[model samples]
Target: MARIKPQALLQQSKKKKGPARISVSTIILFSLIVVLAVFFLHSTYRYWSQRSRIQIEDKESVFKGDDSFLDSKKSDLPGYAVLETAKGSITVELFKDSSPEVVDQFLDLCQRGHFNGMLFRHVIKHYVIQAGDSDKLGAAEDWTSKGKNYNRLYTSLKHEAFMLGTSKTKHDNGAFEIFITTAPIPDLNEKLTVFGKIVKGEDIVQEIEEVDTDEHYRPKSSIAIRRVTLKQSI
Candidate 1:
């Protein structure tokens, strides 16, 4: 190889290009765009979350009514229902405003005498006492077919002791089977509709709870609802 000259090497070095450098303004602009995109996504998510929560709260407010606890005063109640059973009388305060559809259905059934003489088929000690089994009375087909399905009514009412609720399967626009809680049933709070609460028949409910039950949680002796009378609120 021939010897290269210093002046020629210097000229070749000067002709070679170096890596290009990015300006600080371009980098800052890119970073700002990324930050704005993340902030926009976060804000959108928060807006939708708050909107969904507000919708649920609004829906529940319709059934929240005035009472929130179990010990509601009789004078503040919307109506009253007296269940004359074989054991004793159970006076229940109807949540007419909170559960208008359910209360109306119950009142209609009482007026039509559909719950009269209905036997208490399901009973459990320190749990619940359930009655109005249309199947046992040979009227399941008639009862199930007469009403439109009400789906589920989400209410603020809880399944406190002496709370009267209808069967989970029969939430329709007609008569529904009834049950009274002997204890606080939290698992059934939103699952069942609470139409009324026992105001004057705690002892009677306790008496019914004490009745002997068989292996199927059914009362050994026949317990019947002789009549149900409705009274308007004063």
Candidate 2:
């Protein structure tokens, strides 16, 4: 009931209140750190998990020698083919669904060693690397004369000229020739069948693209296809 001085009232108020609490900024900063830590840990876990799964799947695919995992229904997962050239290996993802015949022919040729020792006849920078010339084979006479059974079979494959942006399977005059473009060539879209695309070793593709060429765009130094191996998930 006695009148309290201003100083005494202030002292009483201070004594009644608890210790100073954390600032709102401090609380917000702590929350942010916690969120960031959780996010980083989650991201790291996901990255390693995905990488491990991919390694396992790749190993299995190599051992199995089947690309059942890359069924045509699943456009996301396409069959892979590795072309081991003198320069380096270029792994391509075959669009089996988009151009089944072309893929089939390519695979068949690869299995039969058709592309082996073949030269990259034409390499236009930022355009395409053209190969698969049976004439380039050491035994050109055999190919020309149609003496070899495989050569005859290759010659017999239908060469349908499907319109650009119209049909997925057919193309102008692709036949045994395979053209790997450095960039999107909409002009050649209908003219050539794009069965596969280089997914890995694009640097090697670029290296090949930059190779010295003749007047006809043919590689001056032999850019041979040492071998073609298939790699796909099972």
Candidate 3:
């Protein structure tokens, strides 16, 4: 049997250790690359997600009727209407310049007594007080298919909010249904046709909002709208 030299044995040992060291370094390098790649992908996804969310929010903000626009002289005239409820009367100033079509349709309904004796069909605290559900509030069955009824009014007005710009918010023309927000909801600015805002009797609106409601948000006790009369500014 040939005996291996000490120097040769040391060389063989070095060769074996060299491959192990290279394998360890290669594995460490590969692991570092994988970690970096995962981190980059996660960061990129987050950036895009945040950018998309910001874009959607920015688009929504545009339709909130820019504060500068509201301050401008081009804003609507101070025409108002009284919504006489069983609780009290709420005066809402119509936005003729901002939402002319909505105001016109509402006034037309008022002239035709479409909202006379309508119930405050739905109420949600810190949300909205909905009315003009003529279908549910005992409107004449014949009026269902008749001229300028609630259903007809819904289809008449183009969702004016979207006319301002594209939006992700759900578009609701709200042609016949009049809803008063209990709070300043910017999201609703372009989603719903905001024909008017309550100028007076906000307390009455608050009272209506506080009314006891059922699971479906309908007032347990009937809150009737006695009449809706449009008052022009002299």
Candidate 4:
């Protein structure tokens, strides 16, 4: 090949095409996707952050004020329950002052041995474990399913982990069906009467929550409530 001059080579290279310019439509589409992704991520973060924050607040409300809160409500002994199950025993500090009706009903049932031999009919892992429906045991009638005129009680209590509350059935009945929150459930706040919280046997709750369950969330292995013993605070 003949020797090419430096100036000629430079001009020839300059004439060659550069990479094609991106279309405005493509740039717009990319920017829109980036914006949408950021928005979705931000929304997800906010949702989980709110959940976590509520859980933290609930813990403070439930566990931190165990003594002072009870003392303020009743100078006398506070009411509590010892739930003996096949798994283990779970001690619950009842909120008698705040949720008197529900707590009284629960105490009555416990004294009558109504909860004994009742199976935990529902279990949603990391959510809740429920029981107290006599109908599930083939009873004539579930007294819990009676009296649909349940006036919703709103309180500062929340569905914190190990917190005990009444389950709202499809029948919209009385506060007989009880449940324990395996995890913080902010959505359940003000919707149900929170009567108690687990003061001990947190591990037992975790164990029961992890049990194998059917499609209806019923425990396959049968976790029964052996007995419920009431206790008076000293």
Runs with alpha carbons beyond 4 Å of true place in candidate 2:
1-78, 134-175
How many times do residue backbones clash in model 1? Answer: 0
Off by over 4 Å in 4: 1-78, 134-159, 168-175
In the range 1-234, model 1's lDDT, one tens digit per residue, is 999999999999888968778999999999999999999999999999999999999878755754443335434433999999877999998887688778777877888899989988877666677787553422222222222332234333474678988865653545478878776654555456778889997999899879887766667899899998877652
Instruction: Report the Cα lDDT for residue 199, model 2.
Output: 64
Clash list (residue pairs), candidate 4 = none
- What are the per-residue Cα lDDT tens digits for candidate 3 across 12-70? 98887744344788989999999999999999999999999999999888866586676
lDDT digits (tens) for residues 102-152 of candidate 4? 777787778788888888887777667788664352221232222133233
* Backbone clashes in model 2: 0
By lDDT, the better pick of 1 and 4 is 4
Error of 2 at 115 (Å): 0.8
lDDT tens per residue, model 2, 1-234: 999999999999989998889999999999999999999999999999999999999899776655655543454433887878988988877877778866777777778887788787776665457665633322111221222222212321122111111123343564365666555443344355556666688888789889987656667888888988877642
For each of the candidates, the C-alpha root-mean-square deviation to the true structure, in angstroms, is 15.7, 19.9, 18.9, 23.4
| lDDT by candidate, in order shown | 0.74, 0.63, 0.64, 0.74
- Model 2, residue 190: C-alpha shift (Å): 1.7
Assess candidate 2 and give its TM-score to the true structure: 0.50
